[model samples]
Target: MQLQKKSKKISAIAQNKNLSIQFSLDGFSFCITDLTTNDVNLFSEYIFEKTIASPELLLEKIMYIFANDKDLQQDFKSVSAIHQNNLATIVPNDFFDRNNLVPYLKYSVKTLATDFITYDNLSSINANTVYIPYVNINNYLFQNFGEFEYMHHASVLIDKLITKIKNSSIKTGFFVNVAPNLMDIIIIENDKLSMYNSFSYSCKEDFIYYILFTAEQLQMNPEEFQLTFLGKIESDSDLYKITYNYIRNINFIESTTCFFNEDDDFSNHSNYILLS
Candidate 1:
């Protein structure tokens, strides 16, 4: 398949070596990252969509490649790649035979990274020939792995980053704006415990509904737990104005920097945190 050249020139750090790519397709995102420096390279979020795969499997697949590659072990201490719609077919052939990864595949998969797994490796589908059409394509199709993969990477990298910041001279909580696709409130404090809640909704009304639901559950006013909102907002987005109005007294900063810029050392990226 022909790939479209990206025109948007986002800033990136110049390096001595070509960067390694990592792709992740778990959860609600198709994400790509440059693992060399914990930099998020590319991502696409699938709003209000769900997936059958777990996020851990996506990381394992990419990490497996990184672990197996000799050059990646040496000069490149990190891995990077983008998760796109192709993940339905991107998993490697051996992934089906690994057996270790089999338990994870609760359902039959039509596509592995390079080749198609046989009918035995897949779950029984109502239609026998459904996935036969996409047997040989290298590019991903019909899957939204990019957003979730990016989130998985971000969650892991950000945990380490929080430690780095705590160790640094900075004294502030790391504010993060997760894409709606990976809309979860997992609190990875100290990178040890995974604690967080999931919030779901499509528009501002839905967001408000979820917030109200949270408020009702906590038995506190909506304002009690400081809330912050982030994502791609057009100039006329009502949420932008509504959020500003609700949290007028509090601080709300745009979180574009966390998306990854080649020139940054991730030091300036800490200020984008949100807290109550």
Candidate 2:
């Protein structure tokens, strides 16, 4: 399958030895870092819409990266993938049964594929439950990359946001993570997760509509509840302008810099916190 290239710029640090990959419906992104020096050696991202119909495209891209970079091929120490597909559901811990996870998913999603899986977030013990959904391309990764850890992107973000909230005095707020054509909305109250879900939007209006609607449904006041933005968002972008116009208390969540060397370019990358 022929894949259209969206943006293909590699960072100066692209020669790093360690690698981390993130897969989304719009595309796949990988970061090369030197764990020894804690510096991000390189970062590359690609966009391919035909990935769903031809999952092999994913393998092709991975191979291309390995083939071109000899440093990445020989010095690679670890590889981890974050599945960004939206077909996931969160269930509470008390009533969660592994055996019934698939059935529970089927009732909510119309999936034709049989390879459903789950990820448990140990950090959120109070809201214990399994996150269920299928990551189609993981099979290809296992066959090619050997053993590696796979996680629902939402699970990672939720865990990170919850940890941040727990350390802060803020008792109630909403966390919004914007991905390519997708968004993850998480609600926290009193240091516990009240709601966690994903939504797809084509425009800024749709995006704001979902936020306002969710806040209204939960009886949250837009002026009172703090809303933190993360992922692919810019302060000058229309999405930010619209959100600011409607929501009184909103700000960009600071990106965690431990995973990569601090650089002006690195700070511009979206979702670095969750992707790392």
Each model's lDDT comes to 0.34, 0.68
Best by the TM-score measure: 2
Q: What is the lDDT of candidate 2?
A: 0.68
| lDDT per residue as tens, model 1, 176-273 | 24333333332223432232243444677664455455446645444544443433332245644554454433233334345544454222222222
Q: How far is candidate 1 from the true structure (C-alpha RMSD, Å)?
A: 13.0
| lDDT of candidate 2 over 193-266, digit per residue (tens) | 88887887888999999999999999999988889888778788899899999999988776555433455333
| Model 2 ranges off by over 4 Å | 1-17, 36-39, 48-72, 126-136, 258-269, 274-276
Stretches of model 1 off by over 4 angstroms after superposition: 1-15, 18-78, 82-154, 157-161, 164-182, 186-194, 198-200, 215-221, 233-236, 244-276
Q: Tell me the alpha-carbon RMSD of every candidate.
A: 13.0, 3.8
Task: Tell me the TM-score of each prediction against the true structure.
Answer: 0.38, 0.81
Using lDDT, give the best candidate's number. Answer: 2
Error of 1 at 193 (Å): 6.2
